[model samples]
Target: MRSALIVWGGWNGHDPEECAAIYRRWLHEDGYSVRVETDLQVFADPAIHELSLIIPIYTMSKIDKEPLANLVKAIESGVGLAGHHGGMSDAFRDAVDYQFVVGGQWVAHPGNIIDYTVDVTKPEDPIMQGIPASFPYTSEQYYMHMDPSVEVLATTTFSGQHAAWTKGVVMPVVWKRLYGAGKVFHSTLGHQAKEFENPQMATILRRGINWAARAEA
Candidate 1:
């Protein structure tokens, strides 16, 4: 069976433990052998190199050089990496290498738990199949500094309602990229675990995880 590692813990606001549980259940249902950890030390374990996927739910946490290097090397060696929201993008604020792998970083959420719409820009992509072309969400509308090489699957437009300078600016909501041989996937949704209850968000997240885990195979 395919193995997956979910390393969670950082800021409690993101409910790292709760979010990890939700994904753990889903990964189990998908026939994966899921190993869950709250410590970053797991990244240094030799077995980490054998996993098929890595899901980092940590938010705004510090990672030591040894473990962070191991994690980076593993991903570069083709193990998949996938995450969402501040957990992945906003993690390890001082670590440029981490942000480089993620392809984006959460800079601001202008409205902060307000209503916004996500536009599906690539409905033909398998990760977005069956999701509506557009959908409404009442959450943090993330304004991220993204890497241009990512394959954007979904996007959102800023109304400048909260931040006038950003009005009419289109931002990527969901994207996938490659870090070395690893597949990297990210979504700016899921401020909380409950947000996954939305069918569209849930579908895209699951598909993204599956796609990332498969890597180039």
Candidate 2:
């Protein structure tokens, strides 16, 4: 059976535990055997490489060197990685190595929380099929520094209503990339667990996770 590990903890404001539960339920529904962990040490285990997928819900925490190394190694060994929002991009503030594997780093949300639109630039992509070209959304509009190598699936344009200088800037909302032999998927949606209640956000995320879980351990 395909298995997945969810290591969730860190800033509680993002509702890491709550978000983890959501992922756990979704993975279970998809027939994946899911394991949940609150400790970062789980990443240090060599057995991590035996799983088919890893979903990180940690936010604003520092991971130790040994565990970070092993985590990277597990992904490079063909284990899949998928995550959303700050849980993945903003999870490790100081670890550039983690960012390297994930393919992007969270910089700012220009406007803390506001109404925005998610434009599906690649609606034809499997992860995005059936989602509209654009839809109304309300959350943090993430402005990230992304790797050029990532395949962007969706994006949002800053109206500059909150930050004037960013008025017309287009920012990536969802993307996928390769890390060594691993498949990496990410979305900037879901400020908290509640956002998953939105069908569009939830559908994109679900398909992204399933798509990224292509490689077997």
Q: Looking at model 1, which ten-residue stretch has the lowest summed lDDT?
A: 208-217
Q: By TM-score, how accurate is candidate 1?
A: 0.97
| lDDT tens digits by residue: candidate 1, 1-217 | 8889999999999889999998899899998999999999889887787888999999998999989999999899889999889999999999998888999999999869999999999999999988999999988999999899999999999999999999999999999998998999999999998898998888999989989995322
- List TM-scores for all candidates, in order: 0.97, 0.98
lDDT value, residue 18 of candidate 2: 94
Cα lDDT listed for each candidate: 0.92, 0.92
**Runs in model 2 lying further than 4 Å from the true structure:** none
How far does residue 122 in candidate 2 sit from its true spot (Å)? 0.8
RMSD of 2: 0.9
How would you encode candidate 2's per-residue C-alpha lDDT over 167-216 as one tens digit per residue? 89988999999898889999999998999999999999999998888545
